[model samples]
Target: LAKTKPIKRFNSPLRKAAALFKELHANNGSKIIARSTTQDRMTKSAEYFLAGFFGLEWPTNVTLLLAIEDSTGVWNNSLAGYYNCNNSNNYRSAGGNNATIEWYETYLADATARLQKLAPGFGWTPKDSYDAQSLCAYETVAYGYSQFCGLFTYEEWQGYEYSIDIQFAGNNAFQSPTGRAVGIGYVQEVLARLQHHTIDSPIAQINVTLDNNTATFPLDQSLNFDFSHDTNIMSILTAFGFTQFAQFLPSDRIVPHELVVSHLEPFAARLDIEIINAPAPVKASRNNTDLYEEGKATKYIHFILNQRTIPLHRSFPDCEERDDGWCELDIFLAVQSKSFEISQYDWACNGDYEAVPYGEVTNGVPTQTSS
Candidate 1:
């Protein structure tokens, strides 16, 4: 079954994270010059944004949101967009002579050991100062990309730290601050333990206890889990209650199938998903499969949720039809109309689904507000 090769397209991990945030902005200081303050910026081109794909889709969230705003932030001329770039033919970094040019420090040591074993089973909380072989980048300023924290778990929250900026223009002060826990990627002790289980007490019977405004479903009600994108993905969506909820759909009523199980992914860094158990692509069979009576199924909205048990492995019993081994493990998320307290730039979801102005949700904490 030896096939796995497909990686090259300027070699990717986002072209080595756009050549390591453009060679850490070429060893320091002033290149700053962004302006974008929102305005449909580029107008779609590049062949109408490449019309869907298995080919030519490498924008890696628009080059990691312009590499967190130009190697380190600034430029919102109402949103012309700018997050650092030198892209030598597509991503060049220190200009490359190539000897392993820091390729994002080996992808920040595999994105910091999968952010420390899948962030404490998806509720995060670990950070003895980051090290599963740590190396995460980004922490800029001049008004672009200086976010520094809470990207999925890990939350020190002070505009999320790590904004080194070599000297002011917008975020102020610089020239060797070297702060942000030594050049960003502070890992804020990875977070996500959003256990609001709404106190039915016994942890809600079979472990159902989610509340940021409720969610402990088996389908009979309760469901709006976005705890502003954290608190452990709102406690694993209050214990796994959605295979779909991208908010404002834009494609077919939006349904997709495929649910093959038996994973636990490569076990150290995990992540080997995608179910639909094969009316097509098969192989990997997670230890000979049967992940609950053979995987693969589709048409989501099913429940029994418990997500991220160290990538534990085994789940398919919950059923709702299409059980050829259950499929639909694509997971999904697209919400960028712009908000995040008015700057992380609403995550740019040009893909579809709605909810981009993320301001209001107060008590629940979706507050990116303050603009």
Candidate 2:
């Protein structure tokens, strides 16, 4: 007890294995030994211990481990609306209103890393490739509900679009892979600004209803509140039992406003959700459609989302996509505008709700910075 010493006879892979072996053997269990007389060697705990303990990057280490783990571990075809990066043979395409190229790449990278670990030989790469032939191109550069401008190329100022779909709950099952009619309730676009255009201009005049901290969507299952058209707006509002939307119109940015819920349907689903300072797009569907596979409603809406741009840079535009749609959206007023505007691009909103995903400015008021 007087003199304690550090225990270090020798250190090695063999020693570590032997130590584990003795511990298990001494535990009084035959379960420790296998018929091969040797067990597969494993050192890292979850393969992430090293990264955390030594302050290394989990991404890089996990990637390396995946590279050496196995030739073919797994490829989950079960995930809906995901591009299968592992199988380069087919394009993993998602036909919806969304543009977040970097986000998809990051998602694919992490996913492929896991797949590679599960199945070592099966390599992974994003189908964000363009086919040499026009046959590869759908009838429209943008297909179904997909509003992708540069989906065919790697352009800087690419177009990103988003939308939401909602249908009667009864319509949940009426199509292949679950058939249901779908209508474009809402759509959004993000693209580079025009040559002389500033982020601001003649506002589009959107009447936002803020409840708690979020803007509201109409309740009607089938009201055409097309901001692009006037007559449609009143009908969309009337479909939701609103005596008058003008009364609930948000005057100040922080008015207690509530949007009436007109109908409930299973087809009312969120696509890519992004809670950014930018205007967040929301759902407003015309009909019901299958959730697993892209349907006409989503396809039609997606077809229109890619038409506009967010005006990122004069020459290089930054596009975005909310593949997973959203519900509660908040916004941090940048240069707090008197009011916000909504753009239909082509697919206008009727009774179905339509608004950008909402979020507020991160640091509060906008500040000026020199170039």
Candidate 3:
């Protein structure tokens, strides 16, 4: 009998991602600025990621900034901004879970009865059916197999995906009152980094103490990595005025929209904002390869979310059309410069205001409260 080849361990997602970045900028971990929340999972993710990006001995190469994730304290942490913003923890943020509940009640009604009949004496509600569906996804991820996975039809799976979409739409995306407020800090930090300056003033959930210090928040680094929660990522997208996801989602039925939470913020989801420099203006050819256009060398900004290119032109009118889905850096900066004002962080998070109905506040702020 022939001997079988030894099985090799698969590369972790964090390591694979780090390896990709290493290819572009090798042995330059010292130049990178990385931060994560103080939570064990987040900090550990940072450790594993740094180890892959730098080396097994990554500690000597780079310093990982740990931000506090407390809600009651005055310390602001962009990675865990939801904890800092009171409104984010209030009923406002519950919109997502509320939306999911509404959706599951409608879609899982039939499934609940059908599954209950199969088990005879076991009573099952829509919540139980939804929990089972969730178990299918979680078990598949954890154990690589799940008996619950095959119980649902393709349409039911689509419904499940929509349920997730509605939850994010109402809770963290455009529909949430504190959506922009929760993510404005991270956006501010990114803008400060791009403009090569420290954040002089405290705004929203920005950690002023660290941001004011050059050592903790250096603006000179070309590469900045921040690890954060999935909900916060969605909030950041809304804060950046990605209006493509600003559409109103109905709880009763699936609607045609760009806001798909499963696709946008799946496990280990990543968003990369790249500053590309081309010798000349570039355009994508018929085959999607970049080709030089007639213009002087210029800097452009590209946004990639979960391996998909997000077209800046769709959100910002100032961003010129390009087949490559890139916006001129100057144009992009100008568009984002107004994000602080648009976010209305102070008013949205702390102002005395009544919450609007779910679909009424579709742009991340209450229209009646926002000035």
What lDDT score is found at residue 36 in candidate 1? 13
Q: Pick the candidate with the highest TM-score.
A: 3
lDDT (10s digit) by residue, model 2, range 62-160: 222111222231221101101111211111111111222333443344444544575667554433321111223343433543433333333211211
The better candidate by TM-score, 1 or 3, is 3
- Put down candidate 1 lDDT per residue, 251-312, tens digits, no spaces: 11111311111121111112112212233333334465533334443222222222332221
Model 2 lDDT, residue 231, Cα: 17
Q: Against the correct fold, how does model 2 do in TM-score?
A: 0.16
Worst lDDT 10-window in candidate 3: 1-10
Worst 10 residues of 1 by lDDT: 165-174
Query: Between prediction 2 and prediction 3, which has the larger TM-score?
Result: 3
lDDT of each: 0.22, 0.21, 0.81
Ranking by TM-score: 3, 1, 2
- Model 3 vs. true fold: TM: 0.88
Select the stronger candidate by lDDT from 1 and 3: 3
lDDT of 2 at 22: 48
Model 3 misses residue 73 by how many Å? Answer: 4.6
